[model samples]
Structures are given as structure tokens and as C-alpha cells.
Target: MSSSLEVVIAGGGSPGHVYPGLAIADALRARLPNVSILFAGTGRPLERHLVRAAGYNHMALPAKPAPHNPLEAVRFITDNALGFMAAAWMLREQHTSLVIGLGGYASASTVRAAVGRGIPTVLLEQNATTGRTTKWLSGMVESVCTGFKEVTPYLSPVAEVVHTGTPARPRFLKQYQQWQQQGEVVRRSREPRIVVLGGSGGAQTLNKHMPDVVSRLSEELKDWRVVHQTGEGQLQCTEDRYPSDTSQILTVSYIDELASLLFETDIVVCRAGGTTLAELALAGVPAVVVPFPDASENHQMANAEVYREAGACVVVDEWAAGDRLTDELTSKIRELAADHQRREDMSRAMRGLAHPDAADAIASRCCEILCGTDMRVAA
Candidate 1:
């Protein structure tokens, strides 16, 4: 890979999408010192801050929000067409050798423009099932990358699909090492420290279920120290309902120190987002995953199933609620706590499922696709 080469990355809106882009961009620059990255996305606050923090040249385009109604979809399409034109202009201006679409407003335009100009294009689908955008654009791209093993069936036959795991923040490896050194700190009760999150934005489903969760936490949970990461708009409600001094609960809208908490945590209850799954695998924290039911193609459930198969996590359907949910968590945590070997086995199995060098793998593959070099994926 040539250091002087330029790569344009499209798709970066939320933390779910933006962080992975940053991870890959960092790896690409490290491997190819002369390589440069340009991120093009809508004016998402998360995208703006993260991209600049990564020190990449970014071009922000105005984009329409995700649409639910037919009229909204039409408006979004019309607005996106204009965004695409701006992205095309950026693509031409940057003279990118490789275009990477990460399945967001920006990627749809930038990647398409690169393809239209006969430039090599690569797309990364960070889910067990391809989304509407990825599924449609996959046929036009040079290759498609994924994090899970279950996506092969959905990929286009003509598309060169690579199972390149999405890279997690390097900090998790450090957290895992520290936790292993500390060993297990036994609590008086059987309940484990359960952390709940719904990607960066948090989930209304998870938030709504929080009241039930707090009120019905198993008796064993009394001794457990619980930390819940409820996304914005749900924090105040979660805090008000579940007082920390009253219960073993610490609820926050977000945690900047996620790496530290992940290391200390014994169990996680979260939406089965690709980035979250990757982080959990790296942290070696067994989880009870509740996938976002409406996620495109139900990929979150598919992702959860993959980990569950490896004995890394348990999947609880969104439909299962109230006492059913509480009982499930209690039973699962006790099962793990009662069996030391089970916990150890799960930790090792989960670690095996992680690819810490996923960013490096993606960067290497992108280089291989563009420069005809052997891209190295770190083990």
C-alpha cells in the first residue's frame, strides 16, 4: 500500500457507524503512512466531532433523516440526490484511489460516485444481515466486508465477500488484561453486574423496559452492583425510577469510561449491535443480548445467535418482557456464577471470537483491493 494514496470513506452518522470508520482509518494510516482518508457524511454531531478528532479531512453534506412515511421517503430521496452530487464532487476533487462505503448517507453517494467513475469501491456491512442500502449497493461494489459468519447467504453471488471483523477500540484489550489479572471478585449475591445499552442513541424499547427491569430485578441482584447505560432522553427517567442508594443501581445516559466499566463488568445486557458485539467479545464479558426487533433484516438477532452459539452470550427476545425477562436474567446469571468452569470457558470462547486487529484487517483488505498488495490481517 502506498502512503501517498488517498482513500475516501463514506458513511459516518452515529457512534455505531462512525467509530468503526475511525478505527479503520487509523489502521489504514498506520499501515500506509502516506495514505490519506477523507470522510464524507451529513452534519451529524457525532460524525463531525469524531472525524475531526481522528485528524482526517472531512466533507460534510446535508442529508435527509431516516423516513417512515412515503412522503418523508420521497423528500429524503430528493434531498439525498443533492447530497450525492456534493459527494460526487468531493470524490472527484479528492481523486481517491479507493472508496469505502460504510452504509450511511455519505457512503451511498461517495461510493456510487467512485463506481460511476470506474474507481475501485469497497463496502463494509457491520451486521449479521445486510441492510437495505448495503444489499442494494453490494452488487455494484468491488467487495463487501462483514463482521459475522451468518451473512454469507444474503450477500450477492457476484460480490466478493470477506468476513473481516469490525475493529473495537484498542482500549478493550487493556481492560481484558486488567480484569484477568484482578480475577473474579466474588459478591455476596449471585447476580452479576448487568450493563444495559442501546448503541449510542439508546433504545426506547430498552428504556421503556427499564422500569420493569428495575422493579423486578431478582432478589439475588440485591448484592449485585448494577450499572445501566441508558442513552439520552432515557437517563433522567431511569435515574428517577431506580435510585442508586435504594438499589444496587447506577444509571447514566452515557459513560465516557466504557473501557473501565467493561473490564469491571461481569455481564452485559445490550442491543446486539455489531460494534457492541465486537466490544463484548474483546472484553470477554458474557452478555444477555436483547436485539433491536426492528433492525433492518433482523440482523441484530442473527448477530446475537452467532455469539450464543459460541456460548458467549444469551439472547432474550424483545417480545419476552416483565417477569419473563427478570427471571431469564436471574436464571442465566446464576447458571454462570454457579459454574466456574462455565464462566472461564465463556471468557475464553468469547476472546476467541474477537479480532482485535479488525481495523488492520479492513485496511489491509482495502489496500489489497486497490493496490494489488497482500493485505495482512492480524491474528
Candidate 2:
């Protein structure tokens, strides 16, 4: 690859989509000192902040999620057309050599523009099932890199399908090494910590139900420290509900020190987003994954199932409520927290599932394509 290679990494909607692109961009930068990355995304405030904070140029597109209502659907179409135009102009203006779609509606326009211009395009699908945009563009792209092996069979027969696993940020690897160094001292501690993650945007069901679950198991969890990463939307309400006297329960709108949090956590209760799962695997943390039922094609459930099969985590549906939810979740957490060996076993299983070098692997492939190695993925 050229030292001055320029590429557009496109995706948004949530931190799940954006972070992986950032990770890949970082990997590429590390590999090629002069590589330039321009992040293309919808003008989401969070996405904008994340990209700029990471020290990358960002191009905002007029893309939006597909709307259900007929009127809104028309707007979506028009917005995407404008988005395609914007992306085309960016590619030409920036002299981008490659376009990478990170699996979201925002990436669709950029990928289409690149392909239309006969420029190279690659897609990173960070789920067990292919995202709608990725699936639609599969046949036209140079390659489709997947987070799970299950995705390979579902992709276009002609497209190159590479199982690169999800690209976890370098922070996870750094924290994992630190945890390993202090593993004995930390594991020997009888009091276990539990961290609840509601994804980047937060999960409403988790926000509404977790406080009660904690309250009901307060006695059992008395010796345990619990930290809940409530999304910004539920921050104030969720915080007010916790008892002021107990230092055992802490609630925050977001998690800034996620790697450290995961390093100390014995059990994680979170949504089954690809990026979240990858971090958990890297940290070797046991989890109770609650799949978002409305997620496209119920992909989260499929993602969780992969971990459950490998003994990495337990899966609980979001719809489970009251006693059904509380009883099952409490039992699962209690069993793991009480039994050090069992948590350790789950941790080993999780580490086995992780691909710590996935970002580098994808970056290497991108370099191969850019440097004019056969663009077609090897069979």
C-alpha cells in the first residue's frame, strides 16, 4: 500500500458501527504512517464527536434510516440520493483510493458512489447476519469481511467473504494485558463486580428492568459491587431510583473507562451488539446478553447464540419481565459471582472466541487491494 493512501470509512447509526471503523482506521494508520482516513457518516451528534475526537476528518452525508411510513420513505430515498452525490464528490475531491462500508444505512450511499465510479469498495459486516446495506452491495464490492463465520454462507457466492471477527479497539488488548498481570490478585478477591451495559445509545428495556432486578437481589448482591452504564436518556431517572446510602450500586449515563470497567467486572449484562461482544471476548468477561428484539432480522439474537454455543455467555430475551426475568438473571449472576472457578472457565472460553488481531487482518487486506494485488478475494 502507498504510504499516502486515502480511504473513506463509512458507517454510523450507533457507536457499534462507528467504533469498528475507527479501530480499522487506527490499525491502518499504525501500519502506514502517512495513511489518511475520512469518516463518512450521517450528521449524528455522537458519531460526529467520536470521529473528530479520534483525530479523523469526517464527511456528513444526508443519509437516514429507512422509514416505515410512505411519506418518510420518500424522504429517505431523496436523502440517500443526495448522500450518494455528496459521497461521489468527496471521493473525487479527496482522491480516495478505497471506500469501506461499516454496515449501516449511512455507508450505503458511499459504497454505491465508489462502485459506480469504478473505485474499490469493501464492507465490514459486524454481525452474524449481514446488514441490509451490506447484503445489497455484496455482489458489487471487492470483499465482505465478517465478524462471524456464520455470515460467510449467507453472503453472495461471487464475493470474497473473510471471517475477520469484530475489530475491538486497542484499549481492550491493553486492558487484557493489565488484567493478566494482576489476574491472581483480582480473582482471589471474594467480592465480584458486575457491570451492566445498555449499548452506546442505551437499551430502554434494560433501563426500565435492571433497577428492580438489583433491588430484588439486594441481599444476595450485598457483597457485590454493581455499575450500570445507563444510556443518556435514562440517566437521571435511573440514578434517582438507586438508594443514596449504598455504595454498592453506581449508575452513569455513559462509560468512559470501559476497558477498566470490563477488566474488573466478573459479569456483564448488556445488549448483543457486535462491538460489545468483541470487547467482552477480548477482556475474557462473562456476560448475560439480552438481544434487542427489534434489531434488523433479530441479528442480535443470532450474535448472542454464537457466544452461548461457545460457553462465553448466557442469553436472555429482552421481553422477559418481572419474576421470569429477575429470577433467571439473578440466578445466572449469583451462580457466576459465587463460583470463581466457573467465571474463570467462562472467561477462558470468551478469550478463545476473540480475534485480537482482527483489525490488522482487515487492514492488511485493504492494503493488498489498494496496492493492486488481485482485487478478487481468494477462494
Candidate 3:
């Protein structure tokens, strides 16, 4: 008889992968009271600290992205494969029941090992396109879930794809509640408020330009509030580096209340990470998406283009992020703020794109699969 009573999830190093993985784990636990959850990650701050703080056990492994050079590729594989072997060994000994790959180097080792063991597995892809790590391991898993149905055409026909929507931090929902309580006074107020996020570790591109942009705001726009999330280390730099007054700007390494910021926001200028896009959609907020240019396969750019085509966001190429970006943003903000009908239409479009129940859906599906419930039953 199978003895594993635990679900093992592999993802870490970046908040992009870690946050969703945590949400899935959190959801699974809420549904399945009997099963335990474990994580395999590279021990990045968000992964290790946040997961642990959430009261879950984390099994750290050494894994890095596969190399571009043929010579470095061998070294990378050897390193990651060994880490995989270790994670597999851990799973083997722990009596793991289900294995999940959330896509990233942290999962590289665990996924390889789990598939070889014939473990029932679920892999989640959050972008409109699958990453190379996920694509390579797609067929090995029993099912592949995606955030957007749009990613379906890119995957292998043999891979069973389900549209699960993207799993976001619980704060997204919590913040929505607060927004409802604030009523029309704050909601309909003409004060222009912009929230800017630089993604997990912070966007170097945003860090450099945001300071300048904050500096250039005119006295007429003095009442405008800019909230900038620059990730951890940049908080101090943001605090002292920029000269903007507290009333005009608030800069932090991270904001625990991200959802609150969303509801209060008139506009969002953020990296086009899948989760950010999903959150913007869920919150019905218009945005300016500046994708990370060096993102693998230019996936961020692709993600941004999807929303742009839908008229949900404006795309700003990373190459042109400084100086005039402030002018460009000011122009767009005024345009979006003045054209009430246009903003409303785009907000409705954004709301249409949200999957508020995605986290619950993925968690429930994985639990059902792990609990010996047959997939033949409808979801």
C-alpha cells in the first residue's frame, strides 16, 4: 500500500514562481486536512522565509538554471541533476504522495526524480507561454495546468492542458474586501493614484527610472500619490535616494498590503509578470506594463502584448524606461484619467480576464487527484 500522506511542491528562488506555488500549497491544505505539505526550493528569501513563516516545512536544494554554453550546460545539468537526485531521495524516503512542479530551477531536481518514480504529478504554468523547464517536463506529468487558455496552442498536443487561471497571493482577495467598504467617496474621487511594482527581487530598470520620474512630477500633480514597491534591498535607497515628499510618494522594499494598493490605485505601472497581470485584471485596474527584456524567451513581452491587444494595458518596452517614460506615463495617466468612458471600458475588459477562483480550482484539482478520486468525475 502507498504510504505517503504528503504533497511535495518544487518551486523557489523567485517570487514569480514561489508565490503561486505557496498559494497552491495553501489551497491544498485548506481542502485536505489529512495531508501534509512540503516544499523543495532554492531557499530564496521569498521562498524560504515566506513559506516557513506560513508554517510549512521547506527542503532546500542547490539548483540553478541550465546554461547557454554547451560546456556550461554540462556543468549545470550535473549540478542540477545531483540536486534532483537529493530531492528525489528525500521524497523517496519521506513517502511522498503527490509531486508538483511550479516551474523554476528549484523544481529541476525534484521533478526529474518524481517522474522517474512514477509519482502522480501536477505541473502549473502561469504565463501565456510555458518556460523551457516546464516544457521539457510537460509530458512526464499526469496533467499540465495553465493560467490562460491562450497558452494551449504552444504546448504539445499530448500534454493534457487545463485552464486553472493564475494563483495569486490571498491579499488580492482581502484587499478587494476593503475596497468595497471604502465606498464611492474614495472610489470616485478624482485624486490620481498610481501604484508601481518591480516584481519579486525588484526590477533594476524600474529602480533607476522611478527615482527620476518621482522627481519630475509637477506642482499641479502634487496631490498625485505614487506608491512604489522596489523589493527588499532597494527600500533604503528608495527612502533616501529620492527627494519626493511623503505626501507625493511612498517607496518601500516591499508592501505587505499589495491588494490594498490595487483598490486605491487609479493606475498601475508594473513589470508584466503573469501574476501582476492577473492581479491587475482581478482588481479591474488599468496599467502600463514594462516587461523585463532579459526574461527567458521574452515571455514577459509576450504576456504584456496579450493584454495590450485586449485593450487592458499599455505596453512600455524596457529599453525605453528612463527619462521620457515619466512624460509618457504622465500623458497616458491624464488620458486614462480624463477619458472616463475609456477607463471604464478597459476596467471592464480587465475584470473579464480575472479568475478569482483559480487558486481554489488548482488546489481542489490536485487534492482530488492525490486523494484517489478519479479524474473521470467532472471538475
Candidate 4:
């Protein structure tokens, strides 16, 4: 083990990318008592706030998303150039030995700089499909740590691929187990509960359509309770959209403690983000996964398909919302709500996919890399 270990984890656009880095940092701390890890984020407000809340040292990078238009494309090149220069200077100033990229446009600069300077680098790909940033950096990084085995086929042939299932924080595991211990009491309750999440920042489409979904199910859900997380500025709209006198529904802008909410939830209607999916699997909560259609390469759909194929979830396309989507969603929800055996079966399947030791596994490999051990996963 290196007496001096310093790692810079760069990535951020959402909690999905950031949390995995934090989990790896947590795992690193456990294995290397003196390991020093810092988060290098995109300087986005959400990323800074989350990194601060996690109580880790953070440095922001002036990184921007790859541009779609010509005007923005010029800006993208300039920003990447500047971000890369800044990252290179930071690595030298901080005496960083390893740089780990979690995924996102924000991660591009630091990873590019690290590889350019010949610093060992690794990337953690969270989706079943390769993210754009991961794909761009695949040929340069020393190793590509993936969350799904399905992703291996898509990565660069020369890259060292390690299948390290996404890490779910230990708190989720502990809280879920406690809830399971009280399962009999929970099952005895006549009231049914479901949670609607649109990612950490909230999903506008889900917020727009959820009230309708609940209204149609209101009569059948007379004994039900709902927790809806509407993204900022949309909470009031969600509240207004709910059917009049809907005492069964609780709508909020965001939830800081989702593990607690999942404790009482029967089913989850949410986006199929990698981190969210990992939490759902750990909690063994059946879900109605609505992948964000615009996700790069439709990775969320690929992620949802993993569980859908395993019979652990129901996948609903975002495009189907205008057509029979609501009807489809309503029917699925009704069926799951009514069929206790089916939900239990789905729960079992979800649990079967959980990798509780994912963080430890990835950490061991990270330590191995730091010690100049084999970085490649055995064939």
C-alpha cells in the first residue's frame, strides 16, 4: 500500500454520476486509512451542493457539455481547452497520482489532462450502455470499471474492463434490512403507498403527467398514499394538478432522505438512472421505469431493460405518454397494487440482482492499481 495516496474523482451533472464516485471514495477510505480523495466537479450548483453535503473536499472545473450547434461547438472547444489546462495544473499542484472519472461531460477535461500527462486514470461507467464521455476516454484510461457486464461489449478493445456493479451506500442496505424485519407489520397495513421520483432535480415530464396518473387511479386507490417529488418550481403546479381534495397524495419539491421514503413505499414510479436503479434493487422495491428519452444513446432504456428482462420492473417509454401511455401505466400500477404475489416475486428478482459488496470490490481493484498490481480483470 502506498503511504501517500491522493485521488481526484471528476464527474458531475447529476447525483447519478457523483454518488458512484463518493461510494468509491468511501470504499477507499475503509481500505486505506490515509487515502486522500477530493471531488473535482463541473462547478454546477447541484454538484457543488451535493459534494459539500457529503463533507468532501471539492474543486470545480470549468467544463461544459459537448455542443449541439456550431456556435456552441466553438465554445465547447475553448472551454475544454481551458478546463484541460486548469485540470492539468491542479493535478500537479495537488500531487495527484490517480484520476477516476465517473462519467459526464464535466469529467472530460480532467480525464483528458490526466492521460495527456501520463497519470494513471480509470473510468466508472454506470449505464448498461457506454456514456459519451466514457467512450471518448476509453482508449486512453488505464481501466474502465463498468456497472453492468452488458457494457463490456461496447467498450474499447484495448481498455481493461472490470465489471464492478454500481455501489449502493451502506446506509441504504442497513435501512432496507430494518424495513424488511418489520415486513409483517408493514404488510398488515391496509393502506398502500407508492413514490414518484423524477431524478434528483426532478423530471418535468413525470411531474406534468403524474397527477393525471394518480387521478385516474384515485377511486381504486382509496386506501392508498402517494409521495411525489416534483422538481424545484414545479411543486405548486403538481399540487394544483392533483384532483380536488386528494388527501392521499403528498407532493414536495425534493427529498433529502430517499432511503426513509423507500422504507414505506410499495412501488416506485421513477426514471431509470443508474444510481436510482441500484437503490431500488438494494431496497427490493418494484418499479415502473420511465427512461429519459433524451439520455445519451438511450442508456436509461438499456438500464431499465436489464430489470424488465429479469421480471423485476415494468418499462414505459416516455414517447408513449400522449398515446395509450397513461392507460398502460394505470393498468400496470393497478395490477401490481392488486397482486401481492406478483410484487413479491418482482422484489425477489430485484434482490437477486443486488451487488452489496460492489464498493468493496471496486475499492480492492483501486488499491491494487495504486500498488502497481494487475489492473485487468481475469478473463
State the C-alpha lDDT per candidate: 0.76, 0.84, 0.77, 0.83
Q: Candidate 4: where are CA atoms >4 Å away?
A: 1-3, 131-133, 177-190, 372-379
Evaluate model 4: give its TM-score: 0.93
Give the C-alpha miss distance for residue 353 in model 3, angstroms: 1.2
Compared with the true structure, the alpha-carbon lDDT of candidate 1 equals 0.76
In candidate 3 the C-alpha lDDT for residue 37 amounts to 87
**Model 3 clash tally, residue pairs:** 1
lDDT of 2 by residue, 34-124 (tens): 7789999987899999999999988899997869789899899899999999999999998988899998788889999999998898899
Residue-level error in angstroms, candidate 1, position 165: 0.9
**Alpha carbon lDDT of residue 89, candidate 2?**
93
Model 3 — TM-score against the truth?
0.89
Candidate 4 worst ten-residue window by lDDT: 370-379
* TM, every model: 0.88, 0.93, 0.89, 0.93
Candidate topping lDDT = 2
lDDT of 1 by residue, 196-238 (tens): 7776688776666655565665464666677777787778876
Instruction: List the candidate 1 regions with Cα displacement exceeding 4 Å.
Output: 1-4, 176-192, 320-341, 374-379
Using lDDT, rank the candidates from best to worst.
2, 4, 3, 1
